[model samples]
Target: MLEGPEIHRALTRIAHEVLERTKGAEDVTLLGIPSRGAPLARRLAERIERVESRTVPCGALDITMYRDDLHLAPARALGRTEIPPEGIDGRVVVLVDDVLFSGRTVRAALDALNDLGRPRSVQLAVLVDRGHRELPIRADYVGKNLPTSLRESVTVLLEESDGVDAVLIGPKRERGEDRTDEARTASGEEN
Candidate 1:
């Protein structure tokens, strides 16, 4: 798990990279892909503002409807998206997310952005860029490059929810490893 100082360091590095690549955040807007990304985007925006002395608009996007696996979960709550008062037109947009694994979330974010407005360019920024992409999407600014297997899940717990900001890599349990126990639990069986 990453400590607060480590997370701050990574965000600082990413901010510098973004500023260097985009030549500053003069005409840039930070758009976070809902939930976790929203806070991350806000944090990055602050870093950019302090470094460049320019305020960049930070917005949250809800792409649940655009997800490829929409049917897997129950209905998702929509988030408020406040693009700069000027909107995303002709601006350099940086999409922020926690972990980049399968690239499906990024894909969904792109689809959602299309309805908002056409930006000058869109770049991705993520904390962890774990290998095992189901699509071709890649992050422009990555905090850490963690090579992981397909059966592992990287979870980011924020201070707001988990009372701490940390990254954890959880290995998925193998199939049939505890089927009997799982079934018993489901059936309300005692130990």
Candidate 2:
């Protein structure tokens, strides 16, 4: 789990890295992968503004339909993808996400970006990087590098979603075993 101070420091460092790599925030835009990624993008945008004295357009992108596993989870809800009024045409687009898991979401995001407009360049930023990538995607900016097993789940609680923003490594459970019973029993109940 990352403390608020740690997150702040990471954002500051990422801003510096972005500025250094892009040679300032000119012609730069932030596109957060919807849901958890939105707030992170907004925070990054705010930090960038503080450093550059200019508002970098922060947009949200929803890639639910574009995901390869959509058919597997048809009932899943979607997120919002808001592009800047100027659009992403000929601009550098940086995609933000909470956790980099299988890299499939990033691939879907790339497809979604292509549908929007031809970007001069596209980069990735993530809060946490867990291994087991099913694709070749890599984050341009990362907050932390965590080595986790495939069975373990990484839960990121943002201030918006959770009272406080922190990353947690949830306990791993065995496959085909129902842990709901354990949860219910711990709550003094049975189902």
Candidate with maximal TM-score: 2
Off by over 4 Å in 2: 172-191
lDDT against the true structure, each candidate = 0.77, 0.77
The residue pairs in collision within model 1 are none
lDDT of 2 by residue, 72-160 (tens): 43234556778999899999998988888788888999999999999999999888887778888899999998788776777666786
- The CA lDDT at 143 in model 2 is 94
Model 1 segments beyond 4 Å from truth?
173-191
Q: How many residue pairs clash per model? A: 0, 2
Residue-level lDDT tens digits of model 1 in 1-191: 57788888999999999999998777889998656788889999999999988888989887767877657544445656667687999999999988887788888889988998999999999988877777989999999887777667566766754577888777765433443423211111100
- Which candidate tops lDDT? 2
**Window of ten residues with lowest summed lDDT in model 2:** 182-191
Error of 2 at 18 (Å): 0.9
